[model samples]
Target: MRPLNKGAKRQRVRRDPAPSRLFYRWQRIWLTPLYRRLISLGLPMAALVAGGHVLWSDPDVQAQVTASLVRARESVERRPEFQVQLIRLQDVPDDLATQIRQAANINLPISSFHLDLDEVKARIEEIDAVREVSLFLRAGGVLEVVIDQRIPVVIWRGAKQLEMLDAEGIRVGYLDHRTDRPDLPLLAGQGVGPHIGQALEILDAAHPVADRIRGLVRVGERRWDIVLDRGQRVMLPEDDAVRSVEHAMAMQMTQDVLSRDISVMDMRDARRSILRLSEAALEERRVQQAIAKDVDNNL
Candidate 1:
């Protein structure tokens, strides 16, 4: 073309577009549906994680945050609306009410949040006579405590002290002496605390002869021995001991056997009954036998 003189400029051919810059690629990706969704969801979570790491890295900051939270909580809890103004006790003796007061150790107009109901109940239950407790906050900001005390049924004398026990064999209180509570029956011996129910049953069965009763003694932690007046004893079998006492009472009514000079009436076998004569009765029997022998020889 006109011999296209050497070094003559030719028409430039258009080149295909080069790949976009990394920034443009990333920008395009950011506008995609998936990238937008990730940014929306992951950005807050990542920021929260980073902030938590920063917070936990400093102990002083963590403590300050905790203290601020606690102060806020306590400020709301100590409001007048949550204050306990009065305390009332139901079915409790003056002594126990005083004990409850002392155990609670709460000041008047104290906040309910400061009073741990469970802790108060446990403290009141520390009294040996307390069987059950019901606690609640009533109208007028009154904290009410209802007590169910254990009733003493028998006096247990052991472990070097005298103690009153309930029907369930729980120790109620320590006593100065047996006569302090004459109304309840007396029980004494080793390992008798757990068997007070059976002992009471035997006593109930022996009511007809109650006047002669000295007390009930536990033998070998298994059986019972009913001591009576005039140095007499009724030995009962370990099992079904109440039946033996009933039988003895019946015999006393009919034969007046307990009034006689007997040392022990053994009913341990249940199938048969044995009697041990006192020294005086045995001596008289010997004398009578000698007299009978001499008379027979003379005949």
Candidate 2:
């Protein structure tokens, strides 16, 4: 091979560097391997979310989506697996259960998905007797309704009719006559329903005089008057009237105070006790006093 001269100009095989494939020049410096993976996943997801938001904003698209969902729901409801063949009720009287069933207004073999359980429960609970109600679909495709009936504690005599109330003072039912539930205690007067708690407490404290109790009479929407079987009444104080009743009961047990010919025993003043003598008793006392005076004068 012939040697080339040292002074000769050498032809350089210059190749062009490949152009950067990255869209943003900064990405080449800032984007790490993990960042590249995140970008690959997040960009498509963000695009899908943005597109969905835009589609949802359109009224026509919204209507179409709603219609599609409704159609899907209807199709699912038509299947036998979703159908309710029967309804069962627990903890309800026969008449009330029948009423609840009627109130449900549901057709047989109805789809559970189509039934609004909440509306059914609300409707059933609207009955004054139903204290609480729960509805659910059983495994056997029966719509089960469980009712908690309010237990009547006392019969309240209103202006027009008598009402049965629970211990919590919730009116549960109506009574044609107060004698229907003679076993239950009777309460009368305005605004007496809500104060059943205090009334019950007072009655309990007056248990010593239960046989003599006619009924409790609410006075001025506050305080109480324990009416005895005879024409006698024990007036109680406004505050802590239960204490007053208990005190009266204790006095009656020891002193037979209620057995005396007293028309009224006013214990309204906690500091002192007062009793009003009956007309007969007052006349007898006056006659005795007059006889004693005559004897002293003669002596």
| Winning candidate number (TM-score) | 1
List where candidate 2 sits over 4 angstroms from the true fold: 1-78, 286-299
lDDT of 2 at 20: 71
Instruction: Report the C-alpha displacement of residue 290, candidate 1, in angstroms.
Output: 5.2
| Global fold similarity of model 2 (TM-score) | 0.69
Q: Local distance difference test, per candidate? A: 0.89, 0.87
- Candidate 1, residues 1-299: lDDT per residue as tens digits? 55857688877888977667987898788899998778888888899999999988899999999999999999999888899999998768887788778977888889898889999889889888899888999877999988899999998888789899998889998999888898898888888877888999999999988988888989888899998888889999999899998888888899988888999999898788999999999999999999999999999
lDDT of 2 by residue, 1-299 (tens): 77668678878888876657774564763477776766787778999999999999999999999999999989988888989999998767888878888888898989887789889888888888888888889987888888889899988888899899998888988999877998888888888877898898988999988988878888999889889976899999999898999889889999999999999999999888899999999999999999999999999
Angstrom error of the Cα, residue 160, model 2: value is 1.3
What clash pairs does model 1 have?
Answer: none
State each candidate's clash count: 0, 0
TM-score per candidate, chains pooled: 0.75, 0.69
State model 2's lDDT: 0.87
